[model samples]
Target chain A: MNIDPVKALEGKVERLGKDLKALDSRLENAQTDAAHEQLGLSNQLKDTTRKLGRTNDRVTELAESVHRLERLLVALNRKVRAGETRKADFGNWPEIEKKELAKIFQGQEAYSRKTFTPQEAKDTRKAIAEYDRRAHEAIEAAESLTHLPANAESLWRKHYKQWHAITDKHRPEVPDDDTHAKDTAAKSAGNEAIKRTRQQIRARIEDAVANDLLFPAWFENAMGPAAPPGRADDWLYTATDVVLYRLLHDVTSPADALGPAPAEDGHRKTLYDRLVSECAEYRRP
Target chain B: MAADPFARLADRQQSLRTALRALQAAGPGSPDFPALLTTTNDEVEAVMQARRDVEAARLTTPNRAIAAGTTAAALIVAVGWFDAWSLLSLLVAVATAASVLVDPAGRRLWEPRARTTVITAALAATLLTPLLHGWATLITAAGIAWWAWRTQR
Candidate 1:
């Protein structure tokens, strides 16, 4: 053992060197494997970034389409709402106009009467002017809402013109002996004109039906069906006129058609009653 | 046979007038005047009720012949227009008539202006059909007619 110490030491050193060489080779192999794994991870990271970018682009495109769809829906909703509003306005116009005309008529009637004092006459004229202004406003409001039937507006204008003419022609303040006579004549003439106008309207309705231009559904409903060829009743014509007046004026109540003053005439009272009943019947569901 | 409501009403009115005259002649101071006045008022009321009954009866009983005739006439006119013009024209005419028939009060047809527009357009297309000839013209006419019909409905 004493003789082999140097050789043994040398052999141990050589074995230690060989072991160090093997550990160094293993470290190199591990670094190479780590480098290959790092490259693969880097490629995966790039692929993930690319997919995220595409996802972001697709999300942006979807958002833009949704925005466009929202705008279209908003526009369509607005159009439908506008149409409904217009229809509602048109439906409400007749009653509003009727109220305004009633006020005007009351004023006209007050001024037309012989019982009014000079001061009362003046007050009535002022009131009539105010009523006229209000009627104009109502008409303007209706016109702004939607286009009304031409005949409806024209008939109103014609009635107003006649009423204005009658009011202007008779000044009760004038201390003339014939002032009462003139007023009476003017009043009678106005009544006659109104009667003629009503007849004309009725004739127009008949003509429109005859020519197949228009059908008077309301009229037919109010007045029983048309009479037989030779069995035509007189009451039918009167009833037709009354119904037409109510329809044209949108008069639903007897007071509106016959005025607040009680009718002393039986025939007039009957007519008004019939009108009220017919209008009610027609309006029933 | 049913009693004539009109004749009954007239008789009641005559009786009321006679009682009124008698009451006037007797004067308000007379003891019988109150009874006469009451009787007269009763007669007036009776007459009014009779008149109302007659009117109610008349209003309910419509002449079926006239209604049928009107509808027939309208159909005939529509059919005649169809023969003379295009189907669109006939459609417009019939639709207009049907609207009146369906809603006699014109309550359902809220847009009179739209109705007028459709009717005018349909008429124009029908009228222009005879004046124009060619595939393009026919297509245009057809388009206009279809547009009118679609818009109206």
Candidate 2:
């Protein structure tokens, strides 16, 4: 088949050549009779000016539409995040949408399959401080999730339970407040704090993608509450808060829970398993 | 053919491990672990006690300071506080608390905590001294007597 573009280019070039010849002839004739050709040149200049104005107007219209759309998307996310109630907020989300909401939902499931053995747990505890620090840096690099959006358009659906969750995860776990009186509570608090860092990393990822808010809740949730000293009947509610937040995230849509850890070999452990183990006492359901 | 419970248990346990392997690898096939679970409680408890004893034998005493502080606490309550020596008693109690402050073991037991506990006790004890004239003396005397008995014994 013949190429339309090449033929069109040839035709345009021929037309342009003819026009140039005409213009050249006119110019020559004008040199002899200059008054006749001046009006035609002015008319051509006006036509070009009108066409440029139309193109400029179209460009400006499209730019304005893009700017308006970007603002609308940001605002819609904030509204959706805000509308969530305690039970209803996370639980009611549709399946496919919630899955697509954050990378943690999609990315980390392979971690669970690792041989999540006691040996791994024992070994990990020693280096956990460093391990968690790296995880934190990784999370910060991912995205900013401050204003939080739900899957739907509801403005009243926002939820702050995730913030509460971080608080609960770091509660003083062992050395029961009464009997372990001789035991150092600072040690207990410190142990739980390390554990909490692992748990919060997931929630923060969720928040950053779902909300535009920086990790305010996650930061506040770090461990080491009042160490070594407590009144009667005091449990570290901080751990519970973190647990509840995770449970809330998890229970809502299994799809919505924090993603699994990266697979070490091929086992079925997850980030959720780590969170559950680290913040053991606080899990609600 | 087996000499004892462990030998019998080990054979049974071996079978159970095989079942555990199957369960962990895939799903419930021939369940051997469940049967062991029903039978092993008593044996487990006995084994756990034996394990604790072994651990206890190997375990060393905690830090020296903690032992010293406990000793001092026991002594202050037992000896120095007795015989109605109220001022002496106060001195002993202060000394005991101070030892905990200086000693690392005591730090482990009571450093961060008992902050409010000690403060409240001091405040309450201080406030009650004047009102508890005869009653207070009697109570103080009784405490001293108890300390004397504890220390002397």
- List the TM-score for candidate 2's chain B: 0.25
Instruction: Please provide, for model 2 over B11-117, each residue's C-alpha lDDT reduced to its tens digit, 9 standing for 90 to 100.
Output: 44444344333433431122452343233323333332332232222221332333344345435543543434344434433443454345322212112222223
Every candidate's lDDT: 0.46, 0.37
Whose lDDT is greatest here? Answer: 1
lDDT of 1 by residue, B33-126 (tens): 4465456446544544554444433422232222233345435544554444444444444454344334332211123333333334433443
Candidate 2 achieves a global lDDT of 0.37
lDDT of candidate 1 over A157-186, digit per residue (tens) = 343333233222322232344555656665
Q: Give the Å error, residue A204, model 1.
A: 1.6
TM-score of chain B of 1: 0.38
Interface RMSD of each: 20.8, 22.6
Q: How far out, in Å, is residue B145 in model 1? A: 99
Q: List DockQ, one per candidate, in order.
A: 0.01, 0.01
Candidate 1 has an interface RMSD (Å) of 20.8
Model 1 CAPRI quality: incorrect
Model 1, position B17: C-alpha lDDT score: 57
Residue A46 shift from truth in candidate 2, angstroms = 99
